[model samples]
Target: MRNPETILEVDDLRVYYATPQGDVKACDGVSFDLRSGEILGLVGESGSGKSTATGGVLRTIGSPGRIVSGTVTLDGEDILKYDDEKMRQTRWQKLSLIPQGAMNSLNPTMTISDQIADVIETHEGRQPADALRERIMTLFRRVGLPERIYSMYPHELSGGMKQRACIAMSIALDPLVIVADEATSALDVVVQRVVAQTMLKIKRELNVSFIMIGHDMGLMAQVVDRLAVMYSGQLLEIAAVRDMFARPAHPYSEILIESVPTLTERKPMKINEGITHDPRNPPSGCIFRLRCPHAMPVCSESRPDMVEVHPEQLVACHLWKKDENGSYVRQSV
Candidate 1:
């Protein structure tokens, strides 16, 4: 069910990759909502399909990967049905990507001004060259970049500066939603903090919705309004950041939060043993059963549906039984 305030709705989204072995279900029946100006942080280990799920939103699934079935609606319009040309027009203007390696995404030969101007020309070509330059300069200032850096090549700027430029470019068209996939993973802690602040500033100023994909739980806690935990191509839990940190519902989510280092809590760290389940041949019942500490016989016998355990929080786990009112009650131990 789509929320009334949702700007982007992903319903039963399934993206698969066809390989010689079999079909790899990169995104299996993922459904979620990105409300207007909401910052939703998607967190999971590598290969958990966090990036693939967001990639589906932009229809950027490359060769061998295809969105098998889904409806990605933006503002009541299903973008999946749009033809190639129509979809091309939606990029940047409606949605944009702050790629994983922002620095590497820039063109080595082109100046920052030229690259940003090119995006403006492609999306809103009616503007004059001076107007485009002015817009670029405004974006540069918005992202905390100086006007002088406009003529500099990507390599000429530092890593953090390059990332800021990427941010400026992403918001150049005033996109409604920005999918920042690992935008701060490569930067130092100080630089990461700065970039994160930059993103928050942009969001507050532009009122742009963000779907940030990263492995940093602490960082996510600081910025995101909600957290979506994924495992083996499936959403395990979704809740407000405060609620999630206070009490995680899913077993996988609990472990993920416990794994992080905290200044207040000093305890012996336990390493995760098994690897993530293979997407091509996931476990029959619950894909996470093999690693879940609280896994019961029922967990291995049937998959659990996502149910509301508390207000504004949903989780998929057999430990909780759903009642008539659609609220989940924990089974007696």
Candidate 2:
């Protein structure tokens, strides 16, 4: 079968934050692609540049933070080059964001229906009141939200309802790609599952792509088609969720997968022992070498380029080298 067409591509995207002492590399040469109708999970620890990378794509980085270099191509166009007016026009029409905190993202004063209607009116101009209400009702139903909450304020809904409401608003315009940055992070476990199911249902009905950023490995396993691991502002590995879980290519990926708790067996978490470098001053060669258990002399010499270690599995690590046949073979330290 043919591969799905690429919908969004981020190439060597670099985002930085200015500070009194130096520039912090919030997203240093991170790269990944979102396939049409596929959900890509961006997983990492806090401050791993997952959100910064998404912010750069949405042109939401402000003040001290800026896109230092690279390109974000959406539907064959480099959106990073769009003028302010064009970008604004493209936001809900072609791309949308379901921000981290639903409580903070919504307006406390405006009713949920009005808030959603405001988005529709802003992008598509004024509509008849009845038609608008019906449209909002359809969205609510699609996301499994009750229509009763449409007239209620933000403070009135439960955490799951608010999140589902946000999801409804995000799909109001039928955007080509939606960046859901920890959309369920603040919810209880039961609520998180419900919200996740709502997102999956939306994806199936709308055939839209997504970039779901979070630290939940279990959630990532259930929802994402492909997984991209991030660390120290760099993409360490990208692979199919099953392949990565079965045979993680990068050491960091292995450690991350191993850290997830299991019910059948008990094992010590492998990720809490390492110390990451300061963002402003990363070490030369491989950024993960400092914390990697398999560090070698070559790891500190020069950075390893992303190499396809197996079919459709890419990893940035010196331990895997191309042999005479051009197949990646493990090397002894």
If scored against the real structure, what TM-score would every candidate get?
A: 0.97, 0.97
Candidate 1: tens digits of C-alpha lDDT, residues 3-102: 7889999988999999999999979989899999889999988888999999999999998999999999998899999998988999989989999998
Model 2 error, position 212 (Å)? 0.3
- In model 1, which regions exceed 4 Å deviation? 274-276, 323-326
lDDT value, residue 174 of candidate 2? 94
Q: What is the lDDT of residue 312 in candidate 1?
A: 81
Cα displacement (angstroms), candidate 1, residue 93, comes to 0.7
Tens-digit lDDT track for model 2 on 231-281?
988999999999999999999999998899988887765546543687788
